[model samples]
Target: MKIIYSLFVWIIFGLMTAFLTVCGMPFVIIGKNPFFMLARLWSKISSKLFLVRYEVEGLEKIEPDKNYVFMGNHQSYVDIFSMISIIDKDFLFMAKRELFSIPFFGYAIKHMGLIPIDRGESRESLKSLFDAAKKIQEGYSVLLFPEGTRSEDGVMLPFKRGAFTLAVRTGQQIIPFVIDGSYKVMKKGAFIINPFRKVRIRFLDPVSPEGVKDREMLDIIRARMEDAQKELGSIGAGK
Candidate 1:
């Protein structure tokens, strides 16, 4: 029964996503918020599709008018949908360069100002960071996974400093978002849904770059994000 339900939901979710993407094409080309709105749509649809329940805490801490460099933990791909569903703003996503190669979606990302980074190319990463800085300067927020990649064991990995460096260099606020239980739902090596369950996402208070040097700021954000993940661990467990 669960398998039948999963297959049914997956088909419906795909159709809805395709429909939304086509409908939002105009807004995406016009540099509007439709692309971001599509994310919210996908998130809601996906939750129902996967039979997953999620709760977000501490959204009030995010400032409305200011741009933020949101550094988050890498758990599962679901984290992207979850965050977009919670935030009521149009923020750009900092993702791998390879994602830009996807046919129609890549073109849409380019139009909507998503910055792609080539992790192996320092020069390209630098260029991407500058582009991200420019976006923040223009009043757009950016999301970065500081851990760089998903943690295979559900343990926090050492964070890369690039996201923090961008925040410090651009002087944008660093918002740490801790995601828990995504791996248990959709992990690194698993594509088949096991048992549907609940997940928790906690948004910690944003940090300012005030008087802090760029070199050491990564550690600060990493500590806060890690601690938040640990706190979420106490609230629940996943099968």
Candidate 2:
């Protein structure tokens, strides 16, 4: 029964993504936010279809009209939906370069003003990082899963430094977030679903980039995330 439901949900989700991508074509000329709205539509639909529940904390700490660089833990594919649903702000995503190879989905991401990084190619990745910084400077927040990959064992991995470097170079306040329960909902490498589970998103205090060294800032963010995970009794930490 779970397998049947998972297969059905997965097919429907892909169809929805393709449909929304077509609907978002007009927004491409209208610029960023409208396409972002379309992405949010896909997220909302997926959440409803999967019966995903979210518990959000620290929204009060998000300031009035201020943009943020949201760096989050990546546990499962479901993490993207959890954050997009919780963050009631216009934001762009920093995606892996490979996502751009997919036909319609790649087109949708480009229209949404997403920055794509090729991790294996340092020169190209750095260029993408700088482009993302420019997007933040243009008044759009960016979301990054700095582990650059999902955790296979529900554990947090050492973050890549690119996100921290961008924050310091651009002076965008960093919002460190921990997302729990996605591993259960849709664990890495499987279509199995643990439907109707609650996903928690806890936003830590924002760290200002002013007068802070990049490595120091990275350490602080990592410590904050680890502490939050410990508080929630969430498992996993690697590298």
Residue 228 in candidate 1 has what lDDT?
Answer: 78
lDDT of 1 at 117: 91
In candidate 1, what are the lDDT values of residues 23-77, reduced to their tens digit?
8887756767566666677777777677667878989988787778888787877
Worst 10 residues of 2 by lDDT: 26-35
**Model 2 agreement with the true structure over 33-82: per-residue lDDT tens digits:** 46678877888988998889888889998886999999889989898777
True-vs-predicted CA distance for residue 108, candidate 2, Å: 1.0
* lDDT of model 2 at position 215: 87
Which number leads on lDDT?
Answer: 2
What value does the lDDT take at residue 89 in candidate 2?
A: 91
